[model samples]
Target: MRIGELGNETGVDIETIRHYEKIGLLSVPPREPNGYRNYETSHLERLAFIRHCRALDMPLADVKRLLDFITHPEVDCGEINRLIDAHLHNIRERLHSMQSLEKQLEVLRARCGDSHIVRDCGILSELVAASHKTGVKKD
Candidate 1:
């Protein structure tokens, strides 16, 4: 099949398919007689794998590393374990930061629960005061 057929099958776009090829994530397929690319079964499988990894929010470089491990299945998988652990740690850190941000926003929101004109808005006053304290440059 061609690029479009492969994209439809994998739910990936044409440009992303081309980018994978360009970045060596997906193998380049042979061109047909009329210069159209002739993608085979392997291309379909590989593209699906890439799409799955991306859906998991795995980094492209980590996906490439995982691909390398595929070629040498007998090697120790300790690195893969470490990579996943690191990714999990980063996610936990972000979740913590987000929770903190939510708390701060909640406090700020409580300051102006009642409707007020722009001049009397507690939220706007707090924001402007905080910005000045942080030395935010006014353009």
Candidate 2:
């Protein structure tokens, strides 16, 4: 089928599909006499696998490693297990960071009791003070 048909069937954007092909993630399909790409069932299946991995927030490099494993069925799955574990660890760290950020925002929110003019805004004042002290404009 054509690139548009493949994208519709897979729910993947045409540019992304082209990018995957460029990056060697998806195999280049054979061209027809009219010069359009002729995607086969194998391409569809591989693209589906890539989409699944992306849905799980897997990095492209990790997806490539997983694809390598798929290509070689004889390899043990211990490495895959390690990769997932590491990703989980990274997610947990991000969760902790987000939680801390939430608490900071809550504190900042508490600075103002009610809406006021920009000149009299406690939150704005605190934010300016913070920026001056840290050299980073964060509130």
The local distance difference test score of each candidate is 0.93, 0.94
lDDT score for residue 137 of model 2? 65
Candidate 1: stretches off by over 4 Å: 136-139
Tell me the tens digit of each residue's lDDT in model 2 across 10-126: 999999999999999999999999899999999999999999999999999999999999999999999999999999998899999999999988998899989888898888889
Alpha-carbon deviation at 39 in model 2, angstroms: 1.1
Clashing pairs in 1: none
Candidate 2 regions exceeding 4 Å error are: 136-139
- Give TM-scores for every candidate, taking all chains together and pairing residue i with residue i: 0.91, 0.92
**Residue 78 alpha-carbon offset, candidate 2, angstroms:** 0.2
Q: What is the lDDT of residue 139 in candidate 1?
A: 92
Clashing pairs in 2: none
